[model samples]
Target: MKRKKNNKTGLYMLGGVVFIYIGLFLFDSAKALQAVEEAFGVLKMVLPIVLVVFFLMGLVNITIDKEKISRHFGKESGMKGWFYAISAGVLSHGPAYVWYPFLQNLREHGAKDSLVFAFLYARSIKIPWIPLMVSYFGLSFTVFFSLYIVVASLLQGLVVEAFSKAKR
Candidate 1:
């Protein structure tokens, strides 16, 4: 039964390619190829960085106990969760994508999904990026956005928690 399903899936994939080719062939073939090449170029550039990051992440996973990390940052006492989230946001480097493995590790170690979401939200509201955002949007909008993001992060955690409880 599974084999029959897999064959059907393969046939569907081939049909999709034929459909796409028909569309592109009837449309602008040159533009489609150019877009494909540009996408491949982007993938080529990112692959090496991702490989190195993955390697480093493997080392961290092997060396550290993520449960300890969750214990260190997951505490909500004395506004510590916010501070931890903010500090982790600032001190962490590289693309936001890089943090997923670590965040997943934290989650496996009993960190709430909302806390992970908050960390990422806080990271996006980077302190250094504030000047750039202010320069582009001006102080009023920038301040509002910043405050909005912080409140939203905590609220996000709470909402997700509520949803999880509801699911049970």
Candidate 2:
């Protein structure tokens, strides 16, 4: 029932060129292209990872226990509810866009959109990424950022619930 999005890489590239032209008025053309190409290269690698992760997640989702998840989530206990929100990230990996289809399916299956959003924010704060971040930002920065991610993700879920109910 949903409309599919067309591939818009050409449009994005064209827009990038326009932005590059304007950027050159204040910056260097060669440097800008190098920066753009570097960014594009990152995207090129990221897209495949995203696709693979999404596919795996989609398959796992179809094969898993929906009833148990539904039961646990429908409860009123605060800690349990919060735990469900946090634990959602246990399976999610890769970039944000990769998780959209899964989240959309969750929403269709009675998942609160806020929880789905929070789950996503939590995914970015993964413990696996900590070692790399620790080497770059030191322990304190990594710790604080991790805490911020958890809190923000929880708050995002809450806000999403508030907005959805309000809209209703």
Candidate 3:
């Protein structure tokens, strides 16, 4: 039953995409073709990364003990939880949406709301981009920006925790 629902959801999303392209083509054929070409270009770049991410996610789902996640990232895990979340976020690559399902699983397994927020915020600092950023903006600026993002991510987590608690 659940599988059927999931299939339907996937079909709906696929249909939506098809509808969008059709609409665009109807409105302006040349522009629509251009958009399709641009989309394919992006897909070529992103698909490989997405596939690797999914493969890794599968490994994680199989190997990582759910109890460990709950123990470390639970509401009472405190600063250590924040550190782990931020670190994971920084190390994560590929598009953000790719992380959503894994993150949602973490949440379901007792990961704190604050840590989730921290993880999302800390994703801004891509390690691979550091060299390019330094070259473009200078070492001092890049270093400072990275540090600021780390700090801001922690702060954002704290604020999210506070707000969540208040709402509850």
Candidate 4:
């Protein structure tokens, strides 16, 4: 059986494009084109980083066993589980949306709420940006900021776990 198509999203996208074109025509055409070119330039710069992150994600999906994930991240996994989650989060790359599916899979496989929160929160610290941060903000400031984020991530996880428990 053929399923009916959802037109809402398509309509919204069409409306957005229409509005952009209208705005372009109403304003300076040359400026609008320039803006578009600049936006594409930024996208070109970011595309490689995004692609690499997805590639690594694919590798992880293929090599990591579901049962092992459950064993390490399950509700009964304890502090060690939190450690693993936090470390993974710190090392995780790409946009937040890219990690959603993996996180959902972990949740389905019995991962604890606290560990999940820890992972999500710890993503605030991008390891690859550390050198840049140090260069821009001084090593001492960067070190402290990173340490603070690590502690805050753990605390955030605990708070989320408490709230989740309370809800249950």
What TM-score would every model get versus the actual structure? Answer: 0.64, 0.59, 0.82, 0.68
lDDT of 4 by residue, 105-163 (tens): 56655677678788888898888998999899999998888899889889988898788
Per-candidate total of colliding backbone pairs: 0, 0, 0, 0
Q: Can you rank all candidates by lDDT, best first?
A: 3, 4, 2, 1
Candidate 2 lDDT over 80-148, as tens digits, reads 756776776644556677667666665454455566666777887767777999999999999898888
Candidate 3 lDDT, tens digit per residue, 56-159? 66776887776777779986677789889999999988778878777776776668878888999999999999999999999999989989999999999889
Q: Write the per-residue lDDT of candidate 1 for residues 2-40, one digit (tens) a residue.
A: 012244876898799778866886799888787778868
Question: How many pairs of residues collide in model 2?
Answer: 0
The 10-residue segment of model 1 with minimum total lDDT is 1-10
lDDT of predicted model 4: 0.78
Candidate 1 stretches with Cα past 4 Å from truth are: 1-26, 44-49, 73-79, 90-98, 126-129, 165-168
The lDDT of each candidate is: 0.69, 0.69, 0.84, 0.78
Question: Candidate 2's error at 111, in angstroms?
Answer: 1.3
Sorted by TM-score (best first), the order is: 3, 4, 1, 2
**Candidate 2 Cα RMSD (Å):** 5.3
Q: Which stretches of candidate 4 lie over 4 Å from their true place?
A: 1-28, 38-67
